[model samples]
Target: MGKGGGQVHMGNKAFSSHSPSPPRNNSGGRGLGGGGMDRWTGVIHVPLSGGGPTFRVAASLIFSPAKTLAVPRANAILFTGDRVRGSGEPAIERLSDAAYLAGLLARKLAGEANAWVVDAACFSRSLAVYRELVPSVDAVGDPRRYDPTGFPASAGVANILAHCVHEIQSTITGTTMKDSAGIQDPNASMLSSCPPRTIILGFSKGGVVVNQLVTELACLESEPTPALSTHNLLVPVSASDVLSSISEFHYVDVGLNCAGAYISDHAVIKGIINYVLHTSKNLRFILHGTPRQWSDPNRPWIGMEKDKMLNLLQDGAQKCEGRLVLSEKRYFDGKPGSLLMHFEILQVMDIS
Candidate 1:
């Protein structure tokens, strides 16, 4: 299971603050302009409590974008879900594998010059020990059972993610910054330009985070409210930036060990529809599923929830004035659901 109690004192320092490893050629100069891009892997301690509070989750981040040496501006940015652990594999050793897969997924979606900010899970199990999948959920119990009873403080998670993006932008631009007051110092990466558009993806169990994000999307206002809560003050990114920077949210073969794998809250779906239809925001949700999760007789709720979500989103998407989209895809339909197919979907699933 994941552990968050130990990293409470990490504060808001970027993983780069700990002598970040130099950028390496991960792609071997084949796709990205005949040159691999720069990749930085580190962990960011996310503060759940406001200013000088006690709780925080250590979210591992990997910044792998098109070669920053030439094209500093990322064509797009991705905030990906955690890569699951294989039997007997250590989390430390899996970092490179996760980073590699993230890069591959980014390239598949948007050729080169894209940024991938991975929200890595602890113990390499997506959403394991610590109950919090994102800042909106309580970081206390078993995450698989972390039930979001009602509307969460939406801005909290989005703000944390946006600050991570800001840090990536700062590192790419080589901007040095003075420390900000309080434990939320990750925002120390001073922003020099507009935020890069983001595409959020949560795979397998990691879809829990994506689920919460869509819930937050429903809570976001048309004008986008400013830092309304104490925790919001910790990050530097504005509310509008959080709302507008995201272009798509992808649930890649998402499944859970519990019920309600996909979003079951109708009110949240309605809120998302209501906001995007009237507001000037364009958002798309691509629900990608494999038989491993969909056809399982043991966990049929997974497929049902995915269908309900797709239906509701599609119903609302029509009136969104091209501002919202919902796409449902079923991969590996011919092959029976198996453990191998579950993981293989990572390399073969269609992102286009």
Candidate 2:
């Protein structure tokens, strides 16, 4: 979505380096900017490897076809499962998973109206990087390790991803909000106005990244951000800007290593609750997971069945007037013989 006339800053040198140069050929394919996947427009590529030995994190942006630009109601930032390699059909299929979920949420918010659509972007990282980021987890079992001291190294990577989301949200919000201000004729503007909400959905290990991003966001929202001071800010913004921008956060079958959610920090959790109650009127966090037996219970991954998790989310809901909801729905309960576990949840998740 075009950002009206405002400037949408991607980031400083770090993100700028990964940006692909504009495509030389410009055809009358779609939108104000002619195109097939406008490298210069909706999408951005952030190279997490940074010319280092470990080429772990990679981010790609995807938006609805220009036709949907008439009514971009909701903006979604989706995180796919980890180690999604190659840009071939396989990778597209993997990314399509996030896109499908994002579309589901968009349609839900849009209601029966078929005019509105959702724009989604996905962030993916390699498992090789996990060993360095989360040293406590056992590589043998994979996605099942607990780092007693908490993941300090992950803060840097998480900050980068959070900053990316912030920039993308800012751009989409500004553009759609402005577009709704009446760029098109009366007949063209959709029945519903541009969405004031942003939805973030994460699945599998990608959910772990979302967890760290939320923790980093909570710390940023604190009065004095000492935690953020330690990490190098790829994109820096005021806390009010970040807090005000986010409308909803969804963790779909988030990875188990996320023991250090908001519950891990009392002050951070308190700050977020007060902020949400006072400023974020419609803000909410949705936690959805599958049955514990379907997930790897042997590993110390944080599951919905885990007592600590219930206590943590329940505490937040209690503090914030039930703004948080935890749900566990069997994904494959049509008298299926096998369990639908972690990955299947994304496939069967019904946003409504």
Candidate 3:
């Protein structure tokens, strides 16, 4: 989606003037698609400024004013796997690890501006899920009551993330849309930075939880009313608000169930695609891990499930036309008998 030279117009009058695009070197080994680089014509290499990982770049079409970004640089919500958040314990250990990720994300988003308000505390510790069915064991508290084991409860997990986004987007006056100061004036450029974008990261079993939550969101998006009556959420939230607030969704080392735990639910899958298509302007997906890990056949139906889920994502990407950027990277040591590297994918932002 690279915009070419064009005139900018508002109403009946065109913008002041049009400037020529930057000159292309056109010489071999330099300009886009020059000689052997035809495929990379519009691509540019951007080194990761904070020294974490290099990001694959595509052409950027939107530009924002150079004003300083105010408080609450971005909102992030992280979901960890089972056993990480001890049953009745305060989830301290997991929170400590999450803080590391929060710092990385804060740095990445802040870029060279050095403005980031996100922290480990911004990420919720964990969202438990169905233990027996999902292949995880609840290590603490009352396993029967705290364990999440079914689709409804899975949906509730998603609702929890949505509620967090809503809360972050909410102002002290209790409104999710921060337009009270005329900041969201319709006349403003549609390309200006969006209301603080929601960043979601899930690791291990949390990846499965995140996927299921996405499935549930897809199901609820089409409903006349997406009920927030689930026991998981501390407060009720509007389904539309939650969906609209999301700008990025990521699943790192999501485990074997990463493929399609809910691919059979076509309505839900379609809802996810539609959400990406219409709801977010620059929404993207970041996926990492070895294919073997993601497609691990721990159960009889898993092989087929993975195929369907991946196929769905492929189809959705094609349908999105260039609006959605999907980035998928693999992290393997290249050594025989190595661990799945599921945990390491989070350190590098893959999949977009």
Best by TM-score: 1
* Alpha-carbon lDDT of model 2: 0.39
Candidate 2 clash pair list: 137-145, 256-301, 256-302
lDDT of 3 by residue, 185-210 (tens): 22312331434444556655555545
Comparing 1 and 2 on lDDT, the stronger one? 1
List the candidate 1 regions with Cα displacement exceeding 4 Å: 1-96, 111-113, 117-176, 179-194, 222-224, 227-240
- Model 3 — which ten-residue stretch has the worst lDDT? 7-16
Better of 2 and 3 by lDDT: 2
Tens digits of per-residue lDDT for model 1 on 1-77?
Answer: 01121121221222223323433332111122113433343333444334422222223232333333222122233
Mind giving the per-residue lDDT tens digits that candidate 2 earns over 201-249?
6665555444544554455444443322211121112333333445566
Total colliding residue pairs, candidate 2: 3
Ranking under TM-score, best-scoring first?
1, 2, 3
lDDT of 3 at 130: 35
Candidate 2 TM-score to native: 0.51
TM-score against truth, every candidate? 0.65, 0.51, 0.49
Better of 1 and 3 by lDDT: 1
